[model samples]
Target: MDTVELARLQFALTAGAHFLFVALTLGLATLVAVIQTRATFGGNPVHQGMTRFWGQLYIINYAMGIVTGLVMEFQLGLSWSGLTEFAGNAFGSALALETMVAFFVEATFLGLWIFGWNKLNRWAHLALIWVVTLTAYASAFWIMVSNGFLQNPVGYRLDGGVLHLADFGAMVANPAALVAFAHILSGAMVVGGFFMAGVSAYHLSKRTSEQDFFRKSLRLGLGVAAPALMVTATFGGMGFGTMQVTKLAAWSGDLAAAQAEMVARHGPGDWLPPVGWVQAGGTWMMGLFALMLFVAAPSTLLMLFRPVVRGLRVWHWLLVAMIPVPFATMLAGWIFREMGRQPWAVYGLLTTSEAMSPVSAGQMRFSVIAFTSVFAVLVLINYWLLARAAKAGPAAVALGDRPIDAPQPVLTF
Candidate 1:
């Protein structure tokens, strides 16, 4: 492969890995915040345990996720400089805003939530986590704004061969970005739900003494899974309207017509994406969505009928099997999203072939190998830590320095 192909592969590896972390982080953070809120307001010890147990897992994923997220940004300047040269004014601004939200806002509040345990007022500590959740979503919003621009190229004008922002509001409100953000957030929720359910299942199947604890956690997981996936399927469908119509046309196996459309509009030499791969990816994602709904629906029903029937070992194993489903589904959707727009770094404005930096093939190959190796190590470490913590159960971990049976702090400052 030449520089462009190697560059595409490297970006794909980094972006795909980073997105898996992102899906879990966004969803798990919100769930942890909600759990903590319930604990603070209701004065429920069970809810407090839930918060600590799941929050630890969220922190594990979030730490590694930050590393991958920073690396993804480096690719824009190092490998795709042509994209920056053409659309830097628009893309760079959104990215700059995202950086501010991530470090200054999200990170600050998250630190408070983590270390503020037993040190701050109960209500104040609860509020900090919620702030972190919102800012994390804001970070995602800015990222989608940049990606949506690449897909739809709205709210911009070309002046002296450089794209300039024409309307900030329009860019922020881009239909593509809005739908994509919803889709992404909903997907994250599903991933989080499954993560919780799967971990709880492991403990329950072992017949741990904390049956009530894992059972509650499983209920919370199933509760979020069904609704979030329903929203994901809905908004994912809505997104097609804003995407490049010809790209969808090609993915639907109507490449001749799509080619004709592209050629007539841009005098294209070739405009076909990987047809087989796109079809398989789209099919795989939808199939998994269906499977998710099938499992979550029954599990949610069981939760609603709780106290009538305990969590069965059969159901526990089923949830364990689903641990990796969301990760696979998210990756498949990403492949469909990015690869389907193939041959264009910014749709219709710039072809991907022209957007690559003048890096030698050897340099691109080395970067690809190095990045992939490092990312693989990070992923393994993340999962290993998460599994170790989750299996340890709530009793084995403590948010405060004291034991679980120690005197609890009141809501006072």
Candidate 2:
């Protein structure tokens, strides 16, 4: 692979892996928080015990996510120094803001949640968890906004071989920002919901003492999962919609500019539109994305919207299919969105090929091999842990406010 291709591949694999962990991390942490909150309100020992139990699992994912995410930060400087050097004055500011403001805030609140349980007041302890969850969400938002600019390259201009911010409003008002974050955040809820509900399902099937507690968790998880997952899918459609319009807008401008060059000689309507392939491809992909959404809705509505099939197996599997559908659809949409705006990393500024590194053939090949190997190891570990946890039996595990063991009996005189 060339250096650019190699770097892209590494980042793609690593980001996807990180996303799997991160999706669950964000979703499950919220799940744990809700569980604990109910216990505090419900005054049930089973609820409290269940909360502590599930909380342990959530904490593990959180730590793993943080550790794995560190590598990406290092790679930004090491592998993509070209990107840094070019956009550092501007891009670095946003990245640094995320690290200092969002990341640290999240870390600090997480510490409070983990360590302050015994020392802090009841409300304060609960507040810590809430703070941690919100900070994580906020962290995700700012980071994605920065990335949004890369995909669309809005509100900027070229200056002395570097792109400088032309208008802050364009960056801040990027339509892609909220839609992307919403789509992603909702996916996080799905990961969290399925995990929590899956555990609860096992408990219900086995008839554990904590059936009630696990049931409670199952209800809460599914409740959140249903809407969040649905919304995730919906907003994914919305993001696609936004991208479709953006594709048209981008193509129109490019076509106009290209036509200007040829219009004088050809006298308008130069046989084909300047961006024929791109506009057509974007429209076609958009239609395909709509079909995917249609396939997704039935499952979402049956499993999430209605209570009639609350514990039905067929419905559950249908919902399971919907879970990953968004990934493919959104990816398709993103392909069209990013590809449509090609030839420039920042519009009227740096070209994508220009922003690439100066690494040699050997360096690129070796880097790909090394990063791919690392990615494989990480994926294996993630699955192994997930499998082990799955086999442990959710029935036997502790959950909030639920009785896992059998009920005690008393003899009457």
Candidate 3:
């Protein structure tokens, strides 16, 4: 393949793989913060256990996400220099803010939260996790702002050969980006809920001693997942009216008008994303979410009948199997939205071909192979670590320097 194709493939491979880590990290961080908060005020042992157990997984995913994110930052300069050169001034500002949030707030607070357990005041420790969560979210917001600029190019103007920011407010308030972030944040929760529920199901299926613990976990997962999935679908559906009109047209299987419009605007060319595949992906994604809602809603009510629910092992197995559904749906929605913005790396401003670096095919091919292989290995490693921790249950997770079998300290609020 040529340099452009190879570069695009590399970007797709790295971005897609990195996003898997990101989705879980975002969702699980919020879950950890919420559960730990309960542990702090209510002094609930189960909530504390839930926090440690899931927080370990969150940290694992977060660390890997950080590595992949750094790689992506490097790629912006190396592989897509044209884009950086053209819109760097406008886009760089958002990226700079994300970097600051990542280091100064998210990463720093996360470290404190991890080791500050038992070392700091209970309330103070809990506050650290909240800081981490908020910073993580802020990091996502800034990144989306940059991506939103690419999608909609609001608040910017072409100055000579470069794009300059004319309205920072408009850039930050980009409607397309805001809706996209909403969709992403909700989807993250869905992923987190399913993950927690799935792991809890595994334990319950085995009839582990911590039945009550896993039950509550399952309840929380389903409760969060149901509403979050609703929001995800709602925001996802709204994309048609946003910046992805042509892609949405393709997804709707009515590409004639969109394609013609693009051709008229930019001259004759295949100016559409992969319509059939995108449509099929969108359909599959919607169907999967519906299936998720079906399972989650019923299971939530069934949680009330503990004995009867426990007897139905099939439901537990289904939950375990359904764990991967959210991840798949997330990836599908990402592809649907991104691929729909075809040909243009920055929508109408610049074509992808023009945006790619002038690097040789050999260079692109080597980087593509190397990055994709490393990301595949990272995925395997992350899943293995997560599975090990999830299966170990709460007992194996360290809540502090305290011994696992130590007497529980009663803290009255």
Candidate 4:
């Protein structure tokens, strides 16, 4: 492969790996906040246990996400210096905000939430998690702002070959960004819901002692996932109208027109994206969304019957198998979004080949190998830690002071 292809491959691997971590972190953080809120107000021991157990998983994923995000930052500078040189004035603003929100504000609140356990007032502790949750979504919002600019190139003007931010409001209010943000958030909730439900099903199928704990968790997971999936689908459909005409035409299999239009605008060249690959990504994403909704809605209804909930051994295994569905769906959607616009790094403004740094193919090759290896290790370690903690059950979680055998009744508001 040439330098451009190698650079694209490297970014795809790192970005894709980081996204998996971010999806779970975003979803699980919200779920943990909800569970913690219930624990605080309803004074339920099971809810408290649920919060700690799921929150640990959220922390594990969040920590690894930070590492991958840093790697992504380095990659942007290392491989795509042209993008920075050309559009940094406009694009860099959003990335800077995301860094502040994720690294400073979100991290500070999460740190307090983790250590504030039992030390701070219950209400104060509850407030911390909500802050972390909001900031997490805020961070994601800014990122979409940056990505949306690439898709639509809004709120910017060309000056001396550099893109300048002409209207910050226009950029923030980009229809492309707003619709994509809603779609991403709802999709994240679907990921979180399936993860929670699947983990609970694993425990339930094992006939663990904390039957009440896992059962409640399973119900919450399916309930959140069912509605979130519908919202995700809705926002996803809305996103189509905001897409570039070339992308929409290409996806609809009218690639010749898209190619001819691009040639007319910018002169003859390889003007079309990889149409088959982009279409395949969309196809897989839609199919998985349907499958997950089908399973989740019925499973949620079935969970209401106590006898059925306890005795559905086969169904529990099925739920466990369904855990990976949303993750796959999210990745597929990401590929469709990112790759569908390709050949252009900044839509009609800059070609991807032009955005890459002036590096040797060998250098790009080495970077790809090195980054992929590191990401693989991080991903494996993350899953290993999560699996170990999850399999250990609520009794073994270290988030709070209350023990299963503690002399005091679990704290009540």
Candidate 5:
């Protein structure tokens, strides 16, 4: 395989795997934080147990995810330095800010929260968890902002070889960044909900005995999942509606300019539509996006309203399978977001071809193979580890102070 293809394959495989772990961490971390806060505030053992259960999973997933993520970061410089340097002024700020500022707070507060449970007061203890949670979300925000820039570059001016910051305020205030952050945060919550539901199901299937405890677990899972799923569905729909309209406006102008150019070149002889077809096409795409949103949102809300299904039987697998469909639909929406900006990496700043590295197409092919194989193996291992972790129950995996459990996908974004 050519190096370009190899790089693409590697990125794809590793990105998929990393998403599994990272999404879990984001969800799990928030969950544990919630539990910790509730236990401190409400004096509830159930919440404390919830904290312990999810905390172990959080640590396991975050550790692995950070490692995988670091590798991805390194690969960016090694394999795609061209893209980086080309847009470094715009992209680098977000990257460096995320790592240097956001991450330090997360790491430090996470340590304090984990180790300070007994040593700290009720308010302090709860505060630590919140700090960790806020830092984690902040970390995610910065990362997403950088990615939003990729999907819709803002506040950038093209220099001879690289893009420069035209306005930092514009980057922070980017409409795309706000919606992307909401989408990502909601995905994390959905992951946590799935984790709770899946675990509840596993225990419920084993026996009729202790049905109450398992039922409580199921309720606990749904408690977060219900609200989150509904809101996420709604929130994503609104975001897409806005995005769709915005895209229509953008394309309408582009097509108008293109058509005008054609008319100028061909004069009145050219078959330019008497009416502006560009506006019509733009409206059609907008409607299509709205249709996708309608299908995706209501269905996801339906998942929220689903009656609790306990047990690890065939039905449980079906539920798990059903869970990702809305997310997959969201993926389709993202495909629109990315592809709709076709032919340009940063709008009019640079073409996609210009951003491509000096590598052959054949290399990108082999890289895909390697990335795929590696991901298959990692996912298999992840499932094996999760099964073992669940077998032992949350308490066993998070005994005393440290973590020794395999990560679970619970959510993939």
Candidate 6:
């Protein structure tokens, strides 16, 4: 592959890996906040334990996610200089808000929430997590704003061959951005729900002593997942209507006309995206959504009964097996949304080939290998840490200020 292809592959791998951490972080953060709120009000030990246990997982994911996000930003500067040079005024604004405003405030608040666990007043600590949750959403919002501009190139004017931000409101309220943001948030909730449910299921299947704890977690998971899956599907459909004509035409089997129209407007070049990949991504996303919804909706109802909740070993294993489904579904949808607009870094305005930096193929290849290797290591370490903490159960978590002698098995393994 050439420099462009290698750069694309590098971005794809790093971005995709970063997204997995993000999905879990967003979803789990909200759930942990909700659990903590309940604990503060109701004063239930189980609820408190739930908050600490799940919050630890959230923190772990959030920490690693930050590193991955930084790597992604670095790649944007390194590999896509043309994108920055041509459209930085318009595109960089959203990214700037996301990083400087949303991300900065979020990290500050999360740090307080983490270290402020026992020292801070209950209400104040609770407030911090909610702030963190809102800022996480803000981060996602600004990012989608940036990405949506790439998809639709709205609210911009050409000034001496460079794009300038003409209407900030139109850009922020872009239909493409709004629908995609909704879709992504709901999809994150689905990821969170399934993760909580799956982890609880694993513990319950082992017949752990914390049956009540895991049981409530399983309930919360199914409750959130069932509705989230439906909402995700709804917003996903709305996203289809906002697609650029070339993408829409490719999906609808009208690529010939779309290509002709593009050539007529922008001059002779291939304008259609890879239809097979786009279609496959959409198909896989839809199929997984159906599967998850079908199981989660009914399982939500079934798990409400005492007998099914306790004695159904088969159901427990099923939930455990379905842990990875939501993650895969989210990734598939991302592929569809991104790859559907292929060959254009900024649709109709800038081709991806033009967006590449002036780097040799060898440099691009080396960067891809280095980035991919580091990302793989980070991903593995994240998984190992989360799995260890998760498997250790509530008694082993060290999130809050505990006794110094308290057995912190999660740290060891």
My TM-score estimates for the predictions, one after another, are 0.94, 0.75, 0.94, 0.95, 0.73, 0.96
Residues 256-375 of candidate 6 have per-residue lDDT tens digits of 888988889999878889899788888899999889988898898887897688778898889988988998988888888888888899999999999999999888888899889888
Give the Cα lDDT of each candidate: 0.87, 0.63, 0.84, 0.90, 0.61, 0.90
RMSD of 6: 2.4
Question: Model 1, range 185-254, lDDT digits (tens) per residue?
Answer: 9999999999998898888888888878888888888888889999999999998888786669756887
Evaluation by TM-score, superior candidate among 1 and 2: 1
Sort all candidates by lDDT, best to worst.
6, 4, 1, 3, 2, 5
- Residues forming the 10-long window of minimal summed lDDT in candidate 5: 269-278
Model 5, position 52: C-alpha lDDT score:
69
Q: Candidate 2 at 229: error in angstroms?
A: 3.5
In model 1, where is the ten-residue run with the lowest total lDDT?
Answer: 397-406
- Candidate 1 structure, TM-score to reference: 0.94
> Model 5 — TM-score against the truth?
0.73
Model 3 agreement with the true structure over 189-227: per-residue lDDT tens digits: 999999988888899999998888888888888888888
**Model 3: CA > 4 A from native:** 399-413
Candidate 4 lDDT, 73-117, residue by residue in tens: 888789999999899999889999888866578989888888777
Of 4 and 6, the candidate ahead on lDDT is: 6
Model 2: residues with Cα > 4 Å off, grouped in runs: 244-344, 390-413
Better model by lDDT: candidate 1 vs candidate 4: 4
Question: Which whole-number lDDT from 0 to 100 does residue 207 have in model 4?
Answer: 93
**Residue 7, candidate 6: how far off, in angstroms?**
0.6
| Best of the two (1, 5) by lDDT | 1
